[model samples]
Target: MRRFLIIAGLSLAALFGLAAPSFATVSEPDDDPLIDPAPCVNAATDGDADNVIAVCTPLIDQEKTGKPERVKALLARAAAFDRKQQFDRALGDYDTALMLDATKPDGFNARGELRRRQGNRPGALADFAAAVKRDPQHQAARANYKSLALELERLGAQLAVKNKPSFDCKQAKRPVQKAICADPELADLDREIDAAHQAKLRHAAAGTVSRRALLRAQDAYLAERNAAFGRSTDELRAAMKARLRQLRGGKAD
Candidate 1:
């Protein structure tokens, strides 16, 4: 499975002509301390969630700091809130920061990541797209947008499959098939694979050696996947992600 994933990744990279940037995980905001309120910045950036909230609250309430410095504090505090899973507060701060400085991509990217974690795919997609529009070279935003696009696509395919399945869910006897039917995430992956297979077939030229080889490879992959029922869902998801990258003609982000 690992070898197949590697091969799929290579195929995607070849198709795209360049390797896609890796997706960025959520992390603390970049620190830019103010000379006048250096302690507020330090507390917001380096302290724990509670300390960040306590210190930033005053700085925010006072409104004495410059807009740039205040935005930095807001972002740092927002990151701290996010770390503590205070999503509403974090989102509010991110909103304020963006409102204060609408030209920058940082706030949008940060909020998009937060929205993704909050299971708001549409909001995350919009925010990521906005970030990319503001700065096309922003790798984080691009990766986030691509990842969300793929997920939403898979979800749509899943819904379609649920309405008109290629396989009979009621009569699914195999462990792998049962697992796929029982888990929505896995079901979505299954639908994505089916869609990719059909797409490949539709695009393949008749009587072509390469097309024949590609079909064989796809069949082999499906067979192996079906037989590996004991594998964890995480493993299956990773494989499906690699396959999706191949189907999309782009390296994994």
Candidate 2:
């Protein structure tokens, strides 16, 4: 009976040893605290700026945290700073996030928008372009690029014509030309008259009697202006206005 009890005790010990390994395996830590990203993500999504900064900063500061988790923390804090109108801090975060991983379009797009608000158009355009290149179907980036490009084009055209006379100011040897170049209102009037006259010439058939008559009228007007400019500047301006009206099919007077 004592030998039977000893055998039973040995069998129980062997069974317990076999189960111990399984228990250890089950009890092992599933997630490492150093690299855990839940707190940063939650704070960014649900918390305000102050909360996000407080919660995410620790994760970002952790050296053991993976690049992906670090980027998330940085982006969250950046957005929080942006909401508080701390643009410089927000930019620093965005720069760090992009430097960590340039593949994400969201980072580029967000940075582009911030740069645009700061009036850094060139920087904004480059960022938007990078975002679009990474993800062609990125709607917001595409829209921003197209809208800014059109605005710049329109501005360029306006700037091209601004305060410019019909005749070149550099070649203004005549008193009338110098006067037109000197006064913005006179320059605008000169451009209008020249544009109207050119339009009439384009509409009139070449080598026809009407075209010949139009040319003659233009020559007469130029001769009269050249002869009258030094005498009465007001008269020259009035004559130019009247000529413009006539070219537009208005009354000759």
Candidate 3:
């Protein structure tokens, strides 16, 4: 009896010793300063369930942290990423915010923009379609459609430019053999690229969109990327401007 009691006491002591440590260290989730609010969207005051606090919190921390002063910061950041051409991150933030609050037309619009920039035409179109559906009165969406129409015209222009012969260049450091670095005609080409890029940005900022608009945005982006063949900055500018005017309802003809 004495031996059994002693053995039981030893076992109980060991169990308590192990269990006490664990219990003492019990982690309080609320006490965790890192515990972000659920949804974890860039602009969301409270995060979303489709992307809950646990999963999205780390994503938010990795890309976007802290509550936005307003939705503006989130939108602006999305635009900046789209500008620097970081499409995936921008879309993640936008989608997260939209998931948190679908009523915010801007979130849907921005996600659509990122999708457009990323070359996800179908995704972008869907997002824009949703935005327009959510808010039919959105002016940005109206302007975006016009911009897309111009982009379609611009695609034709780009094909024409591609067929046009590149001029002689004095640029020695050109990476490509067929580059048009310093040609006098470069001025026009530069404008076209800029226009396409700006149109892309305008679409991103539109806060609403359409399928036609999404396709045009994609075409414009491709045109812009293809323009970088040691082309003259002046030419880039010209291409961009012409394209911009075209997007703004001007006839390229």
Can you give the TM-score per candidate against the true fold? 0.52, 0.58, 0.33
Worst 10 residues of 1 by lDDT: 30-39
lDDT measured at residue 116 in model 1 versus the true structure, 0 to 100: 94
Clashes of each: 0, 0, 30
Q: Model 1: clashing residue pairs?
A: none
Query: Where does candidate 2 stray beyond 4 Å?
Result: 1-35, 166-177, 183-253
| TM-score ranking, high to low | 2, 1, 3
lDDT, each prediction? 0.82, 0.86, 0.55
Q: Which wins on lDDT, candidate 1 or candidate 3?
A: 1
- Predicted candidate 3 versus true structure: per-residue lDDT over 1-253, tens digit per residue: 9999999999999999988745356666753355343333443333332233234445445434455422444444555555556667567657656755677766676776666666775666667667778898877754554565476587778766652333333433444323434343443454444455556566664645654575677576545646564434545445555665565567562
Candidate 2 C-alpha RMSD relative to the actual structure: 10.2
Off by over 4 Å in 1: 1-35, 44-47, 167-253
TM-score of 1: 0.52
**Tens digits of lDDT, candidate 2, 47-138:** 68899988898888888888988988888898899999999999999999999999988889899999999999889989999999999999
